[model samples]
Target: MARVSQEHLDARRRQILNGAALCFARNGFHATSMQDVLKEVDLSAGAVYRYFSGKEELIGAIVAEVLETVRDVQECAARESPPPLPDVLIPRVLAQLREVKPGTLGNGEWVFPRLMIQVWTETLRNDELSALMTAGYVKVRAAWANLVESYKVAGLMPEDVDADAMARTMIALAQGFAAQVAVFGAASPEVLRDGLRALMSMGEPRVRP
Candidate 1:
């Protein structure tokens, strides 16, 4: 078969991805079917298959899209603000996190956090999904490292702060925190804000006793 034009391919792929995200959000990833996505996009099953071979690939695309949004937000935050990096970064990160808040019942909170946890859990059982999640994590961490590095270059951070390590630490905290809130619901945004403010402040010089 002839390959479709790149622009047409991308546009059609995006349509499927958007529909997949909505389906995954409403019904957890495991519960959503390719047929449901086809209906969501007003496409027939064959049309959906043309864009993506299967549901897993569609989910991968949706996750990639979310990761891209995170990268873009972090990038813009780095450029548009003078940072304590955490100050600028947290608001953007938290804004995304807020989508999953228990009270809001927003689509983002329901679909994304739940689907992400599902993906992470599935990674242990499935290698392809594991690889996709790992790649997504690495990309997100790299975006964060660049953001943290901006603070170091500005002298806002202590010279000793390890940008790469700090980036991983940030991702770890978010992953753990999301799991925590999803499970136990102990830490809310206010708790995270105050805690992160203290953690981020470590770079600041301490007063002499």
Candidate 2:
């Protein structure tokens, strides 16, 4: 018997992951079963099980993949001369998401963004998933905070601005945008950028005399 090449093994794993992503995106994590993934990938039960033990493991793998992609985007942005502000950075991250995954349902809905929302919900009940998500968020938030420091160094933002708070705000903004896109299926990245810019442009609040 010939041994399988590493490339062949990697490709098989990717195939299983892609199929699982589609199934979860269409029917959600809870509703999607291992059998659904097997049918989607046109692989035998043994073949799929070889890569993933079950649906939970598959969901964890997919979530980990998405989180890794997000971290890569943040790290790339952080390496820039003066990292982009939330307006530019958030949309850039979203664009990269479109580029990397590029998987859409028949109705033209993006796959990963919708899947992310589902994963967020799943994390609440699953401690392992919740821990994974929390760790991912912490790293992403640290990257954003570093970007905020870059803005301060570049004189784009005030020196006194709290980096951690600003990071949380940016994360919230991005997550809210993803939620909008997932639920309404019509959120505009341009509008998100414009809104962030407008918020940034606001003058200090004043009390009426």
Candidate 3:
């Protein structure tokens, strides 16, 4: 019997992952069963199981894939000669959040924002997923902190600016934007960009007292 090529194996793996993503995105992690995924992909249970032992593994893979995309965006920003400011970087990140991957529903809707919200909730009950999310958060925040450091070095931000604090703020902003998008379906990257610009243009805040 001829052995399957590595490319063939990888494609099959991706096919399963994509099918699982669709199922999870539509019905959610808890509602999506391995059998549902097997049906979605039109593959035998054994074929799907060969790639993932269970739903949790599939969810982990899908979450990791999304985080990996975010990491790639952050890494690209870090490579810039002068890293982008919050207004620029945040919008870029938001735009990425709106991206529709292959496994996502193709109804011109943003599936990732909703899927991610579900994943965040899952982390509360799943220790392994919580750990995975924490690790991914740390890495992404570290990348943002590095960008903050670069801004300080470039004299764009004040010397006393706290990189970690700024990084946390940026992450919060991005997550909040995603939440809004997930709930309202009205938030746009351009709106976020304009809001950030307006806030930055206000200069430092002062107490009215």
Candidate 4:
């Protein structure tokens, strides 16, 4: 047999996960099974099992991917030299998610966001998934809180504002937008940007120069 490159291994893994996502999106996470994934990927049960032991494992992997996406955005904030403006960071990250997760609503909708929402909905029953998602959301909220604190220090935010509460509001808005897209269809990037602008403007009153 020809040597399988690391690239090939990674591709195969994604291929299986993509198939699993389709099944979960169509049937919901609790209803989807390893057999469904195998059929979707058109791969042998043996081949698929090598990557995931069962449906739970597959869903876990997908959940991890979603968490990583949020973490990646946080990393951008922590690493950037000047860091992005609050308005820019919120809309930009939400827009990126909207762009990347195309056809998740199925009919010409994105996939990633839909998959995320499926897992999120199922989290109501799955304690394991619930804990994982909750932890990820907490980390993301903390990162946003820190970002808000930075803006406050730079005199861009109001002194009396609560960084933690404001950050939660911002993140909650973004999360709501993501859920809307996953359930309906993709929204215009301007919608999120405009919303963020309005939210952030509360802190920066317009000055008549």
Candidate 5:
């Protein structure tokens, strides 16, 4: 047998995961099945099985993809000269929320945010998924914590500001936006950018008055 190229393997895995993502978005994870994914991919049982054993593994891959994407976003923001987060990071994030990548299920639909919401519910039942969420949360929190600490050190933010809480607030904002998109359709990038700017202008809360 010819050696499978890494690119080919990656492409095939993405194909399976994207199909599964759409299925989860359409019918929540509890309702989704390996058979549904098989139909979505239009692949032989052997072919699909080679990539993902079942819905469990598929869900894990989906969660991992999200964490990986977030890490990439952090890395991208860090690489910029002054980290133009609003000018750069927000646009990239909006693109993911928009599901700019190819592979449509039907009728030009994109199911990323809804699929993510389903994954959140699945975490309550699956220990593995819950663990993945916890671990990913820590990584995300740490990334934001570092960013927050930098502002604090620069005397931009208060010294007593809780980095962890601030990080969670940011995460909450992003998740809330995703939830809205998941329910309604994707909004224009400018709309999201404007909203984020307004939220930023409010500034991180210091104490409840």
Candidate 6:
């Protein structure tokens, strides 16, 4: 018998996570049974059990992956070559919306809507989950804050501009827009993108030398 390497194990874990996301997206957190997840993954019940002992554990992993993905994408955007604050910020924020799982519009309707609703409810009832979500958002906010501060340094922002507050507001707006898109189902991705662009295009009387 051949022994499985750590790389193989890690690949299988990623596959499982992808499958679980699909399953949870379809059936929702409360309605999605372990059996539903089993159908989604190629692994046997015992194999999945080896990683996540229960449904909550599996969901926790999914949530963590989502947060990590957001952090990673934003970090990459922040490192991009020098650009004005609005220019740099727009791409990162829009890229994030473009990548949101279940998606920001269209086909994401059935999957992401239910999933986010479940996560929101879970956050309300589960203190640990709430802490995790808060911490994750804080990390995301910090990345945005750093980029905003960069803009301030470039004189794009007024000296009175609050980078931290603006960053928090940006994140809050994104979250709100996502939830609205999920609920309204009327706004297209193009519309959402334009709205974001408009927000970034806001200007003050100050000019950089």
- lDDT-based ranking: 2, 3, 4, 5, 1, 6
Q: Assess candidate 5 and give its lDDT.
A: 0.75
**Per-residue lDDT over 1-209 for candidate 3, one digit per residue giving the tens place of the 0 to 100 score:** 99999999999998898788778878889898888998999999889888899998988888887777777788888778788878898888767755525434666556777787899899999999999999988888888888888888888889899989988998888888878877777466878889989888996779798
Q: Name the top lDDT candidate.
A: 2
The lDDT of each candidate is 0.69, 0.85, 0.82, 0.76, 0.75, 0.69
> Which stretches of model 5 miss by more than 4 angstroms?
86-88, 97-107, 152-159, 202-209
Candidate 3 lDDT for residue 86: 80
lDDT of 1 by residue, 1-209 (tens): 98879999777877777677767756667788888888888988888888689987886776676677777767776675475456446545756744422222252244445555766766788788778777877888888888887877777777788888988887776667667655554455566667878876676678899
- Look at candidate 4 and give me any clashing residue pairs: 102-110, 103-109, 103-110, 104-109, 104-110, 104-111
Tens-place lDDT per residue, model 6, 1-209, is 99999999897787777677777766567787888888878779999888889788887887887778767766765676553344334445545534544332236454454566678877888887888898998898888787776666666667778878987776666566557755676455466567767766776968769
Against the true structure, candidate 4 has what lDDT? 0.76
Number of clashing residue pairs, candidate 4: 6
lDDT of 4 by residue, 1-209 (tens): 99989999998998887778778877787787777788888999999988899988888888777666766786678556566875678677766654433334346666765776887778999999888888888887888887776776766668889978987887777778778877778786578778777765675667889
Which structure among the candidates has the greatest TM-score? 2
State TM-scores per candidate. 0.71, 0.89, 0.87, 0.83, 0.84, 0.79
Q: Model 5 compared with the native: what TM-score?
A: 0.84
lDDT of residue 167 for candidate 6? 79
Show the colliding residue pairs in model 3.
none
Candidate 2 residue-wise lDDT, 1-209, digit = tens = 99999999999998899888888989898898888889999999999889899988988888777777878887888788877778898998888777666678889888877887889889989999999888988888888888888888888889999999998988888888888888888667898999989988999889999
Candidate 1: global Cα-lDDT?
0.69
Poorest 10 consecutive residues by lDDT, candidate 1: 100-109
- Candidate 6: the clashing residue pairs are none
Q: List the residue pairs that clash in candidate 1.
A: 99-109, 100-109
Ranking by TM-score: 2, 3, 5, 4, 6, 1
After superposition, candidate 4 runs with Cα above 4 Å error:
98-106, 202-209
